[model samples]
Target: MGKLLLFLSLLPVSGLAGEPVALSEKTYDPSLGVLIIQVNWGRTWKCGQFEHAQLQALTFTQLPLEGANSVVLELQTHSQIAAENTFLPYAYVVQPGEYQLTDFDVAVAKSKKEVIHLKGAKEDMAKAPQSAGTFTIQPGEIVYVGHFGLDCTEEPFLWRFYIEGRSEFESYIAGFRQKFPFVKEVPVQFKLFSTQRFGNPYALENPTVH
Candidate 1:
């Protein structure tokens, strides 16, 4: 467990496969399954394109498992986005059961600067990363549902997070595994409606991959 957390703490393994793959046919543990909620930086939306700031911090709260409540999950990034794709592994190890993900927040900073939390009523036209959702994991099934894409280039800057479910999501998992070899190969069970937003603007669109 410590080793997995250590691997996730570091950001961007520094390379990507020439072509993305949809990892659909993978095996899972018969007694234990894994859940990965990855936050992508350095690839799309010119994240960290023109600034020294990188996505150094991220956190989520209120993840209720069998007997756990408000279990906080966090990840950190250290690599600067210099025209590269950095995948920060924000994975959580949980028992097979129903879980609710909510109260998500993110922070970006340069070296030695104070981190800022971005979960509030006001901050952008749409608070995509602060989205919430529910999911179920069987005893022998692994799932992938949470994903957030930070776009620093846009006006007012925002997190284009989504509930990915399709080939693209599978491709992301394949890319993630390639970038971080520490991640074990597990079957992906992505749900289309497993992700939704919290707070306002409440009418924002929840994106999904097909």
Candidate 2:
């Protein structure tokens, strides 16, 4: 636990935002980078399971002498997207730098009336080791950051999660392109850790900042 405490100490006193905003602008400062990730949480969202899951936020902790300050990225759940799919891409503009796609928090429901907190240790939650989550981004680049999902099982409070390389889902790719045309033209990068998200499938107007 000493290591974990030390790591937490390194975090900035204040987070970037209380709630992360979705990508609305097609155009941003070319001087920065955009990091993207998607979560597939179909299993947990179906409602018959003992545990339910909700993503808190994603974190990018800057590497010393190698990158900018840490960034906390929030997301609009899949239910909010106009597209018809379980996948949700959380795109955020960030400062170009090296970072570790560290851990995140999940509010897990143990039962109809009981909820639990599933937090920390991405290495444990993801199939990939700690090293896979480390990556770098440069000015004007768009990074993929991998695609992952959560697998709900019969076990209570226990989830099967995975992390992997870029997403190859054609429909998702198309949605990404339509939403951010210029971003697609720029070569994309990947920095997401060995993956992993859930929900009603809340429908809302798309956050298209075109």
Reference-based TM-score of each model: 0.47, 0.55
Q: Write the per-residue lDDT of candidate 1 for residues 1-210, one digit (tens) a residue.
A: 011212234322211221112222232234644556655545333235332333444444433332343343444445445534544454444455555443334444433355444553322312442254455656655555444445564422334344323444546656556644544444556542244342112111322222
Candidate number achieving the greatest lDDT relative to the actual structure: 2
All models: lDDT? 0.42, 0.45
- Against the true structure, candidate 2 reaches a TM-score of 0.55
- Looking at model 1, the pairs that clash are none
Candidate 2 RMSD computed on C-alpha atoms after optimal superposition onto the true structure: 12.0
Output the number of the TM-score-best candidate. Answer: 2
Off by over 4 Å in 1: 1-29, 41-54, 61-71, 79-85, 89-92, 102-116, 120-131, 151-186, 198-210
Off by over 4 Å in 2: 1-27, 40-51, 65-68, 75-85, 121-132, 153-172, 190-210
Query: Tens digits of per-residue lDDT for model 2 on 75-191?
Result: 323442232324444666676776555565555666668877556564442444244355466887766554444444543232223222123233344566666665556654433
Prediction 1 TM-score vs. true = 0.47
